[model samples]
Target: MAFPGERSQPRGTILIANPSADLYGSDRMALEAARGLVSLGWRVVVTCSVDGPLVPQLRAAGAEVVILDVPVVRKSMLSARGMLSLGRDVLTQLPRMRRLIKDEQPDVVLANTVTLPFWTLAARSCREAVVVYVHEAEAALSGLARTLLTAPLRLANGVIFNSETSRRVSGWPGLERRDRARVVPNGVGGPPETLAARERLDDMFHIVYVGRLSPRKGVDLVVRAAALLRDAGIEPHVELVGSVFPGYEWYEAELRELVDELGLAGHVRFAGFREVVWEEFAAADVAVVPSRLDESFGNVVIEALLSERPVVVADHTGLAEAASGFAAAVLVPPDDAEALALGLSRVHEEWTDYRRAARSDAPRARRLYGPESFHARLSQALAEQAFPVPSPSMKDASWSPREVLD
Candidate 1:
């Protein structure tokens, strides 16, 4: 709600910082966030795990890039290897981030994603300007992630969330000194050409799900739904995208087996990760987000809307909130294979008009999710000016109180 015409005064030189690289969806979002901040005339500096698909892209976005050789690893649930692996790797990387922190001395250090709350700790000397952008779970927040991310998040000034759901899940709504939290949903802005060319894919129907094959992400649920579709005699050609995050190969094995067991071998294909998915969108008709738990927001759903592809999304978390009244997207409960199949079938049955309406309304949604709003909001975070308390000027101008607090 604080985006678009929420209309607050703005500033510049805000630091848009986060954990390194774009190998993951949230990481890719980090780069896009940096580009957006720069577009709004702010001095943006990105510090991520030094190696990944996004380092060069961040450099090209006119932001100062510092590589923190943080061994950023993803942990799997119901296991010990993932926990120990993440703890050891992140603990080792902690000191490396210290050197970068002292050197940058940025106005505000925006820690993109929950995984790198350590950046918040590093920015303590900078203070107030350390905005921790919480999109995904870190090692220290809840469940197992909380145990790992414990140390770094201690020094964060404000927490900027990608969705209200993520903020609530993280339990950092608004505390004290470092309790400032703002929910500025991630924006959608790729090449306009990607969107314009989507009309040519008018004939084919796509049931696209883009994300790593992880237990938490619930990629296997989609595979199961594919099987359910097969049982019903609907041959839904599923384009499974993204690879497994490191140390989570078992999740991949499970998904692969489910796909095989359901007799959907030819119907379902693992497409891995694609640099740009405009062509993939062209080949498909609808976007499917079937995450089982804790998705802050579904960027693919927004991107699908941009490409004018109708979305059938999991109805929990921010995805449900985002899909509210959107003409092109349909919402179904998470983990409900029956509902997933029903939604998918309904979308392909009547796709054209929804696609056109989606394209028409996408710009409005894009504006809500784009850089200008993000910059102004993030600038405020760096400035530590979120929810400004009224001063003498306000007392002099107005004399009425809306309500009494306690």
Candidate 2:
């Protein structure tokens, strides 16, 4: 019952809970946010799967990161094992969370992502109002996750959604979550200075996609698009970055077969999940985001633009709005292979104009979407919810760009 301004606890702490760590955009962003929070001198704690790509980075960032053995999203959607996994998630983590409550007594419980916010509900019951960060605009929530968020979202002192689209998708309409739902776009670290500049620009028309090979991500669209290009006497080199998640092996295999059937064996390469993925983006002429659904704020597109690379995105979700802002990117119909292929060719044909636009937009993004702004906005939101205050510069832009980095 520790609602905002109803308690007198001076010392404050926050626990960030997540159910995954597959080195995807969301996971990467969570790591950045955690590290930024620590630098701000806030005692932070993060709990996720025991074997995540982020553990070492978390430890280095000066956070008390605890890797808990929990069941993540299983491949077999509805199975006895999945039910048992959910039970273990609730039972196993609940006690560990109870113990942390007694020891640290955090002032706020901030669930980093939506998929695993039961931890927030549990922690809020013991502590203050929970602050849940909704990263995905519309995640396929299980019955339990749906029940968990609906009422408690109202119960929590605050909710921070990545975009207005996300808050609405979660069913908090008319800004019911808006009073507390502050939109603090993610901040990305500046691309490494050593990122490989595109040297084979004239030699090859390479199209790169940097995300997991999941069905919703629309990697198949890229596969099909590659075939379309080949048919039209164009062979664009396509590179895929990021590893397969649990239960997504079948999808990965299907993608592999599609690559073979399309005769794109040499043209399309599966660069199996590298830790540092920017180098691949750097080496390509264009970055492609062929997502069919669930891209609340596609961070990869911005990263592509950061390197002065043009992007071809599905003309839906928040990405289209994102791509339009700087005029540094191109918007094509979602999952349209022919359109995607045509877009790729245009980037090759008119490289000068696109690169010219990206050069102007990249610096503006550095100030607006970089780490400094993220920390500043997040700090203010946490403080405002913890205390009380008002809000930002541009009130709102109708479907404009919103970030989701760290």
Candidate 3:
């Protein structure tokens, strides 16, 4: 298992273990972390269970990507039979993970999410430093499930949470006393130039929702909100710009049926999955994130703000934190279609104010969530766990913000 860039005198090596290869929120954050490590002159190798769109992006950023049969813990695998399967996977995959770590001789093993608990355990058994980057905040989990999910954190040398809400909800013992635990928000990339809101040539107000179409994401609420607007004589066109998980196809079907039931079949459009959503935001009068569950953080809200589009988001947990202090964003109660519709109506009535606020706040959003800030903070966090801080002379000459953002 020879990896590329086998250097005799590299500064250090880091192997990042991630659960998925899809280019979703956490997947994009993992890619950014790899780019950050590469910029710091570390030999970056990323391992995933399967390959998808994120593999090439990692390689292009100077990180090596390896596909392996990594054991991942999912919520559906918490049942009796599922627990047996998980135990079997741990028994079989642990040795391979240990061997890989021994072969790579990495300075640190970074488990990207709690789902890859086996990676942390393997690294510890090898006497290697390990860090867990947590991207989930499952408040709905049972007591037994939550304990099992966070048990791996005790073995980690350091832990990074995406938000304060996430860290608080985790409730892991000694986390408050731990010096290495930190909250680093997701770095979201946006269009090169912030485009102004497009003028409407017709009576239709375009709305866009850009994330997974699962029930937790509350896509059905978005559809129902559009129906409410129509019933009140406001013509709104809703575009859902993402798809569902592997087994959640039925949820998407239900959404479509709900649209037809509310007589919004002509108003709602399923735009499907998209890698780039700036064009969708450009065409939308407003963006909505109506998640029913607690999101660790809201990357899409930041994306909408960066795109200079007014946003309506469910105000709870990380979603509230993401939209906080952004005047262009309107917050409504979670899972309330009427409240969401009212928020959307408020933005429509005061369209001029919201538009100006969005344009005015675009630069601030860039300053806070841009790639440069994200890479700097993430690299520093990982570097601290791997080794001492590098001096100015040790910085990589080829490292640039443009390279990572691209």
Best candidate (score: TM-score): 3
How many backbone collisions does model 2 have?
Answer: 0
What tens digits encode model 2's per-residue C-alpha lDDT throughout 1-406? 1223333333257677766766677678778877877777667787776667787777788778777654444324334556466666677667776676556656567777655556665766675546777776655656554444454466566778766556656745644625777777777775776243453455557788888889888999988887887787666788988667767899999999999988889898888888777678777778899888756776777788887788888888667655658776888888678888888777767777887777777777677678888876776677555434212443342221111100
RMSD of 3: 6.4
Error of 3 at 243 (Å): 0.9
| Count of backbone clashes, every candidate in sequence | 18, 0, 0
Tens-digit lDDT string for candidate 1 (1-406): 2322243433244455555565566677777777766765556767666567787887888778776666543444324676566666667766666666556545456767666554665556434356677785332335555645433544565666777767666644234335566777776664456444244333334467777778767677777777776676666788988888668788788887887778778888889888777677756777788877757777877777777678889888778866766888888888888898888777655656666767775776677776567756655554444224445566446432111100
Error of 1 at 111 (Å): 1.7
Stretches off by above 4 angstroms in model 3 are 1-11, 79-84, 171-173, 199-202, 388-406
Candidate 3 local lDDT, 1-406, one digit each (tens): 1112232235478899999998887898999888876876779999998899899999999998888888789998866677678988789889989999888978788899899989998998888888899998988888778877888898888898988888887756697687768888888888876679965425898999999989999999999899889988789999999989999999999988898898888899999999788999988989999999989999999999999999999999999988889999999999999999999999988888898899887888888888888877776676667663334774554442212212
Q: After superposition, how far is residue 109 of candidate 2 from its true place, in Å?
A: 1.2
Could you report the Cα RMSD, in angstroms, for every candidate shown?
6.8, 7.7, 6.4
lDDT of 2: 0.70
Question: Which should have the higher lDDT, number 2 or number 3?
Answer: 3
Q: Write down the lDDT that model 1 would get.
A: 0.65
TM-score of each: 0.78, 0.84, 0.91
Single out the weakest 10-residue window by summed lDDT for candidate 1: 397-406
